[model samples]
Target: MRIVILCGGESSERDVSLASGGAVARALLERGHEVVLVDPAAETPVLAGPLHFGDVVDEFAVGKEPPSGLGRRLLQERMEGALTAGPVLGLLRDADLVFLALHGGWGEDGRLQERLREEGIRFTGADSTACTAAWHKGRGQAALGAAGLPVAERAQWQPGIEGVPQAVRLLLAAGPVVTKPVADGSSVSVHRVDSLAELERVAAETGSGGVELLVEPYLPGREFTVAVVGDRALPVVEIELSSPLFDYTAKYQTEGVSEVCPARIPADFASRLQELALRAHEALGFGAHAYSRTDFRCDAAGEPMCLEVNALPGLTATSLLPLAASGAGWTYGELIERIVDLAMS
Candidate 1:
């Protein structure tokens, strides 16, 4: 099968996406599939020749901050122009499957998926509608809540909106609040605020940049994630954060976090987590053979509450989906192969 892996977009997760794309390309190549890696945001989109794992590993040596200002503007311009470029579209149309290794921005937010669908190209994971619903944290939480899934109490705030601070103050009255971009991945710009002053500072700083934010009561229990591939939920993986929040550095840098696969919890609890994960996936309209990863955190009562569903979960070395897959007795190559098979089916 000929597969074109899309990675490294104009989003904050560009480096992480490159790492995922490289790792995926290598796995698919080892499985005897024709793999081509394309960074849609690049000046020359197609990444020719075989991928070297060493080079790929270096791509994600990301700093604590995301790309900004001039660099980001240039990349956005290139991404907008490159997607419709003849070479890029030709590769997409020619491939048997276009595996999305992208994480945030337009790539994972449904815009790119919609374009591909309009061009009559097949891609892995959920369709544009599902992606759109899942990409927005508030929207996804609403859908999950409507489906009777437990979700943390949350309030939404856009930049420059009046009375948002008051609402956030009300939410924070419950306890320390977690704030993050309403639509983002890799935990970019995520922060935990325990004081009104700090919350004000965070809101002011974040809002000044025109980013929408969601504030929710901070869950004080264990953190876990479940990945659903096709119709099956893989084993649960527990996250142990070295910091108060699972920010960008903690996610990509190995030392800041530890993940325990098949999380060492009671069998019933794990089963419940898996069930909720699958239910959340379905509630978001993900069809058969679609894949997603649902994140959770236990509340003060130790009951699990849904955080958000990753429409296109990362496949990087430290990514939870592959770790959960490993716990389910699937090798890295086998996991990639399974995803390809599901997409082609």
Candidate 2:
């Protein structure tokens, strides 16, 4: 199969996406498939750099890492722009499938998926409607709640909306609250606030960025995530982080964090987590073989509260999806092959 693995879009997760695309392209090549890795943000998308899939892995293995502090800010500034898709669409014309190794922002927010559908291109991951429904946290949570799935109470902030601060304060009055952009992934800009002053500061900081925000009472408990592919859940993975929050660094950098695959919990609890994950997937309108990672927080009563679902979960060497896949007895190469097979079928 001739595959164009799309990655490195203008999102905060661009570095992680590039890593995932490199790994996927290498794995598919090992499987004897022709792979073209493209980054939509590149000025010359077809020739951004040498496709050196394995070489990229070697570089990371040698400690070429994600940018930090000022460097991180500069890279993020460059990635905040929209994607230019002309060159990528041209590459897709000769491809059997465009494996979506991209994450967060527009890549997972349905715009790219909509464009692909318009061009009649087949791609891995969810359809545009499913992607849109899942990317917007408010809509996804409502759909899950309507389906009788347990969802944490959340309030959304819209531009030009009055009383935004008051609403957030009310939410925080219940307890510590988690505030994040409504449509971002990788836990970008996710903040936990325990006081009215903290809520005020977080709201001001988040609002200054001009994206809609969602505030929910922080569910205090163990954090676990389940990866779903084709209506079934892979093993659950518990995320333990020394940081106050599992932000982007903990996810890709894998520092100050530990993950337990096939989480050491009761069998019944694990089963329930899987069931809820699948239920949330369907309730959010994802179709068959829609690869996603659903996060949860087990409350005092042991009930799993749905955090949010990543319709396009990270597939990086350190990503939770691949970790869960390994626990299910699927090698990384096999997982990539399965995703492609499902999309092509």
Candidate 3:
């Protein structure tokens, strides 16, 4: 198959997306599939590092350049262009399939998917409608919770300029709440606020301008993520962070953090999580999501608290999904193959 791997975007997650593209490119080639890596605008990409997840690829990352050499350069050149899909959807005209690794904003939040739909292109993962539903943290929470799934107590702000006041009030109500760009992955702009003062500060700091905020009751539980490929959950992973929380730094900082697969938690918790993950994916009308990572916080009673899901989950070598896939006995190449198959099928 001729595969076009798209990454790098105008969003804050550009670096993370490129790293995912690198791993995807190598994995596709190893599986004997022809590969072309392109950025969100569909331009050729170049990075000077090991290209793994969380290596401080640039200033945006921590403060280090990933180990570099032949591997980095080779991955950089495997693609025809490194531009984002925003401008390069034209370039994908003749490709067999588009495998999107772009995370956050327009890339993952359904903008690009809508464009692909208009162009009548074949791509991996869910469509624009499903993409939008899954990315909107508050909406996903509502849908799942209504379906009898366990979700943290939460509220959503309305859309439009008038939405600002409603947003602040909601934030205040969900106090000791965690604020984030509701549609983003990798937890960008994610933070905990304990007082109205801090909550107001964060409300002003939010990107996407008056975009709805997902304010959920701060629950106490272990954060575990379930990575689902197609309709199946790969495995469960428990996140252990050395920091106060698994913010962007811990997510991409790769220094001392570790992930325990088939998490140490009891089997019942894992089963419930996997069940809810599939239910959430289905609820979104995600006909063919190639990769899905459902993040949750399990309370002291082992009750799984549903968080948002990542439809086009990261592909960096050390991402949660890859870690779970490894435990499932699927090599990097195998994982890529499974994703591409679902995406193009």
Identify the runs in model 3 with alpha carbons over 4 angstroms from their true place.
42-87, 157-175
Between prediction 1 and prediction 2, which has the larger TM-score? 1
**Tens-digit lDDT string for candidate 1 (108-204):** 8999999999989999888899999999999999999999999988988886766456777888887899999898888988889999889878888
lDDT of 3 by residue, 61-164 (tens): 32232222224334333321333333354556667888787777666778778877787888888888888888888887888788777887666643344444
32: Cα error in model 2, Å: 0.6
Count of clashes in candidate 3: 19
TM-score of each model, paired residue for residue:
0.95, 0.89, 0.82
The local distance difference test score of each candidate is 0.87, 0.78, 0.70
Off by over 4 Å in 1: 50-60
What lDDT score is found at residue 241 in candidate 3? 74
Preferred candidate (lDDT higher): 2 or 3: 2
Error of 1 at 195 (Å): 1.7
* Superior candidate under TM-score, 2 versus 3: 2
Per-residue lDDT value at 121 in model 1: 93
Estimate the lDDT of model 3.
0.70
Best by the lDDT measure = 1
Q: Once model 1 is optimally superposed onto the true structure by TM-score, how far is the C-alpha of residue 303 displaced, in angstroms?
A: 0.8
